[model samples]
Target: MYLADGLVPYTEVFSVLDWWKVAGTRYPTLRKVARDIFAIPVTTVASESAFSTSGRILSEHRSRLTPDMVEVLMCSQDWLRNKCKGEQIM
Candidate 1:
């Protein structure tokens, strides 16, 4: 019951003896067989929607951006992303 109800994707992963290696570092029986297991190349960006919000918040051209502007941009981003769902993304 524990295995069935306690876990979802991790359980699916652990079913394989190879992936079970992630659970315990001491267990030398299993190695990292799932090297390129990630469906996406990167996990952090995949978890997010778009970098447009980031772009308005940060500038690569200049390093003198103020912290207050960054904060306001972040707040606007969170609000728009969460509340303005039906609006056209342009």
Candidate 2:
């Protein structure tokens, strides 16, 4: 049986995991799907931002870089950007 008739917006929160940790117990079946939903990338903003960086990396001056090298550079840039949690404009 559903615990609440409807879900209310939670306020005063920190992380997504924190919300799931508390609410999961109240709704096991829902929680299973909710965790997967939360696991998804959820947006293309990161990829778009990465493409912007890739453009910069492949400019005329650096065009001599080989295909494999280009791939490495692009992947490295994406990894570093994510590691730093840099902000990307939508």
For model 2, what is the C-alpha lDDT against the true structure?
Answer: 0.74
Q: Which prediction has the highest lDDT against the true structure?
A: 2
List the pairs of residues colliding in candidate 1. Answer: none
Candidate 1 structure, TM-score to reference:
0.29
lDDT tens string, model 2, 13-63? 668677668778977999988778778875657765745663467778888
Model 1 poorest ten-residue lDDT run: 26-35
Model 2, residue 6: C-alpha shift (Å): 5.7
Task: Looking at model 2, report the run of 10 residues with the lowest lDDT sum.
Answer: 47-56
Q: What C-alpha root-mean-square deviation, in Å, does candidate 2 show against the real structure?
A: 12.6
Given candidate 2, what's the lDDT at residue 4?
Answer: 50
Model 1: per-residue Cα lDDT over 1-90, one tens digit each: 223534436443445555455543634332333433533366565436554654455567545768887677677776777676876555
lDDT (Cα, 0-100) at 75 in candidate 2? 79
C-alpha lDDT score of every prediction, in listed order: 0.54, 0.74
